[model samples]
Target: MIWETLVEPFAAYGFMRRALVGCIAVSLGATPIGVFLLLRRMSLTGDAMAHAILPGAAVGYLIAGLSLTAMTVGGLIAGMAVALFSGFVSRVTPLREDASLAAFYLISLAAGVLIVSIRGSNVDLMHVLFGTVLALDDAALILLCVVASITVIAVALLFRPLVLECADPQFLRTVSGLSAVTHFTFLALAVLNLVGGFHAFGTLMIVGIMILPAAAARFWSVSVGGMIVVAAHIAVSASVAGLLFSYHHSLPSGPAIILAAGVAYALSLVIGPVGGLARQIPSRPRTQL
Candidate 1:
């Protein structure tokens, strides 16, 4: 009974299969980035950039009327521009990076809403805000797969520098001048994944895939590689659970996935052994003196 209830929906429906694949692909790309974001203390930056991509997509909606290519291109352009410009502002001005990103996040979200209102109805708006995961077409699914492939390769190539860049920026600068390169590269990859998944998962909930799984994993492991592995598993589990929940309850798909991730995080907070409520500080047993 349990197996049939869980596997039947996906086996019977092609859309369910596509949604599952899309969620998995996005999770693979988003997990490592989320780990890095958490390590760098930039968890909310993912949220900020998620909102920051809206204006660009809204512009595409304004001009092309829900054309996927148009909206995607617009989102890529806008997300990259905001990311780079905010980094520039932080370097050149007194405002910190978080402050600059937060400012642009608010502005971009408001502008995106207004622009969407100009051309799209509430229905269109909801699609952009929450996404239609169960209704992913071939183009969007293909895009997610491609983004996942590119992200895996790029992350593998950038691994060493990114680790150094995240763990110790000053030492990285002195040893190798790839600090700026790695930072911007990281931002680009992040924006790429978000933009790629925006049409399928929407901007608001996509970050949940990136951050929540990584957050849950932090309580499961200490090594970066271990956390990444655990995070990927968490992401896949959340996607599966979320799809099942939506299927059974007739709820919105995207939010259901995020909510499932939220549940995982809540569970991790309570029972995870690394840093969870179960063990606030991991301590080794005292050796005999």
Candidate 2:
């Protein structure tokens, strides 16, 4: 039973191995960014950026149908542009960061859908919108690994600045001259990771993998480091479980992975140690009226 269920699937298939590797790389790199986004109260930023990539990927589709390089490059360019512009607005303009992101997301998403409808059929649109994880080539795998590694190292280097900025942006702005630099740099890194992740997980569902694990971890841990660790574990678990389920059931690989993550978040909401529903028992007795 074990051999048929676990060993045979990955052992017999090469794509399964690649999918797992890419998912791990994505989980390790993107989950931590989600944690920071949550910490900074910018969780929607991930969604906005994910939507922002749609226009670029659609443009790439318009140029070259189903071309991996074109789509990746286009998505990267679009995601980065939105990230920088939003950061600039947050720093210089009176409008809030979330406001700027929301505006950009709506415009970008509409433009993308319109562009895709211009020359593509519903099948092409579906393919572009929800990418196939099981079809990853060697180049995609390499890019995923490299981006993941760079994100891990960069996050380590920027740990203190990020925490300080998240805790008190005003203080960090006044005390450290690198607050803007730190903020923009982190956003760039996040965009980069999102671009890489969306290539494998699809633009629509990649943010789920990024955000849900971190959300679940919040219910399990109070410390930033602990949350990151827990988030990574949950993400990896979801990836593996989702892949196995997809393999056995012939399901859409990307959604399967994210659905597994959703399950984890749901379970954590009930049973996690820190703030889970199960732990919300009353500690004080009610006074009789």
Candidate 3:
């Protein structure tokens, strides 16, 4: 009975299969980026960048009327611009990258909202904000797969420099010119994954799939590689479970997935192997001899 409930949806419905594939692609691509963001203490930066893509998507909507290709291109351009501009500003001014990102994203979010409202209906805006995972078509699936593949390959190529940059940026800067390379490359990957994620989970929720699973995985593993592996597993599991739950309960698919991830993060906070609440409780010291 449990197996039937869990397995029958994908078997019975083509949309279910497509949704699963899309979610898995996002998990594979986005969670690794999330891990690096977490290590660098830049989870909020990921969120900022996610918002930064909205104006581009809104512009694409305005130009082409919800065409995925246009929206994707717009999002990529917008996200990368924020990243580059933020980097440039930090170098030239007293403002730090985080503050620059925050300011840019706020402006972007306001601009996107205004743009979408000018020509779009509430429903259209909702779709951009929250996502439409169950409605993914062939083009969306293909885009997701391509993005995930590229992200995996790029991360593999940049892995060593990325680690060094995160661990010891001053040392990496002194030794190699690759700090900027790794930073912008990772930012590019983040944009790509977020654009793909917007298709599956929308702009609002995509960051959850990216950061939540990675954050949860932190409670389970100590190594970067292990954290990434665990994060992927957690993300996949959450996607599957969330989809099933949504099917059974008639909930919105995107929020259901994020809610599932939220649940996992909460559980990890309580009982996870690393710095969980339970683990942090100091046990009575052993009596001295």
Descending-lDDT candidate ranking? 3, 1, 2
lDDT of 2 at 9: 83
| Candidate 1 lDDT by residue in tens digits, 1-289 | 8877899999999999999999999999889999999999888788888898999999999999988888999999998888778768999999988888888898988999999999889999988888888888999989998998998899899999988898889999998878998999899999999998887788888898899999999999989888889999999999999999999989888988999999999999888878797675334333322
Per-model TM-score, in order, reads 0.95, 0.92, 0.95
lDDT, candidate 3, 170-288, per-residue tens: 99999999998898899899999998899788888999999999999999998898999999999999999999999999999999999999899999889998878888765434333
**lDDT tens readout by residue for model 2, 176-247:** 898988998889888888888877887888889899999999999989999999999999999999999999
Ranking by TM-score: 3, 1, 2
RMSD of each: 2.4, 2.4, 2.0
Can you tell me which runs of candidate 2 are displaced by over 4 Å?
Answer: 87-100, 284-289
Q: After superposition, how far is residue 204 of candidate 1 from its true place, in Å?
A: 1.0
C-alpha lDDT (0 to 100) for residue 127 of candidate 1: 88
Question: What C-alpha lDDT, on a 0 to 100 scale, does residue 194 get in candidate 2?
Answer: 83
* Candidate lDDT (C-alpha), each: 0.89, 0.89, 0.91
TM-score for candidate 3: 0.95
